[model samples]
Target: LAKTTQPISMDSYEGQEVNITCSHNNIATNDYITWYQQFPSQGPRFIIQGYKTKVTNEVASLFIPADRKSSTLSLPRVSLSDTAVYYCLVGERGQGGYNKLIFGAGTRLAVHP
Candidate 1:
């Protein structure tokens, strides 16, 4: 299993883009990088997932290098409502659910007006 590390906090203003990066030094061949976001009093929600290279969705984009040692979650034109605690996780999905998923301390993103 790979240990992940991320910044303790970040600050951004509305309409600006924010990129939170996580580093996983020992990522395994089968391990996949996933990002989650949690709002006040709400469970963490899925944001994006990637193995290598780049993956994009309606909400955000995830970029992974060929080495697969790190990943960046790019939020475009963030808004105040997007303020939340972002979690970077690494694991694989099993028949039951996510297996052996290791979560980091998380990055608290403060979106200013």
Candidate 2:
């Protein structure tokens, strides 16, 4: 498992674009970067996943550089409702004899009016 480093907290106003970067210096070659968002009193929800280059979805975009040492999660025009704790996770693609996935403390994002 790769160790993830991310901001403890971030502040932003409504309708602003927010980019959160996570660094995993020990990331493995077969590991994939995955982001999840968790709102107050709710379980973490999957946001995006990527191996390399860039991947975009209706919710967010993930940018992984060639080295795959770090990844960025971009949220477009974020609103107050988007305020949540975002987690950066790295894990193997297949079962590969690994039965559990580990998550970090998470990045707390506060969106204001």
Candidate 3:
């Protein structure tokens, strides 16, 4: 598993774009970058996942460079409700084997009024 590095916390105002970057220098070739968002008292939910290049969905966009060593999760026009802890995870899906995703300390995002 690749270790992730992210900020301990971030501050943002409502209606602003928030981008969080995670680094994984020892990322494996079979590994994929996945982001999850967790609200208070709730479990983490999948935001986006990408192997290389870019991936977009209704909630967020994931950007991965050619090297696949790092990735960025982009949130557009965030609101106060978007305030949560974001996690960057690197792992491969199991193929007839038990595959587990390891989560590092997540980045806490604070959305202000």
Q: What digit string (tens of lDDT, one per residue) describes model 2 on residues 1-113? A: 88899999999999999999999999998889999999999999988999999999999999999999999999999999999999999988777576346888999999999
Could you tell me which 10 consecutive residues in candidate 1 have the lowest summed lDDT? Answer: 93-102
Q: What's the best-to-worst order under TM-score?
A: 3, 2, 1
Ranking by lDDT: 3, 2, 1
lDDT of 1 at 34: 92
What are the Cα lDDT values of the candidates?
0.92, 0.92, 0.93
What's model 1's overall lDDT? Answer: 0.92
Please provide TM-scores, in order, for all candidate models, with all chains considered together: 0.94, 0.95, 0.96
Candidate 1: tens digits of C-alpha lDDT, residues 71-110: 9999999999999999998877665764777667799999
Clashing pairs in 1: none
Whichever of 1 and 3 has more TM-score, that candidate is 3
46 in model 1: Cα distance from truth in Å? 0.7
Task: Return whichever of 1 and 3 wins on lDDT.
Answer: 3
Q: Candidate 2: where are CA atoms >4 Å away?
A: 96-99
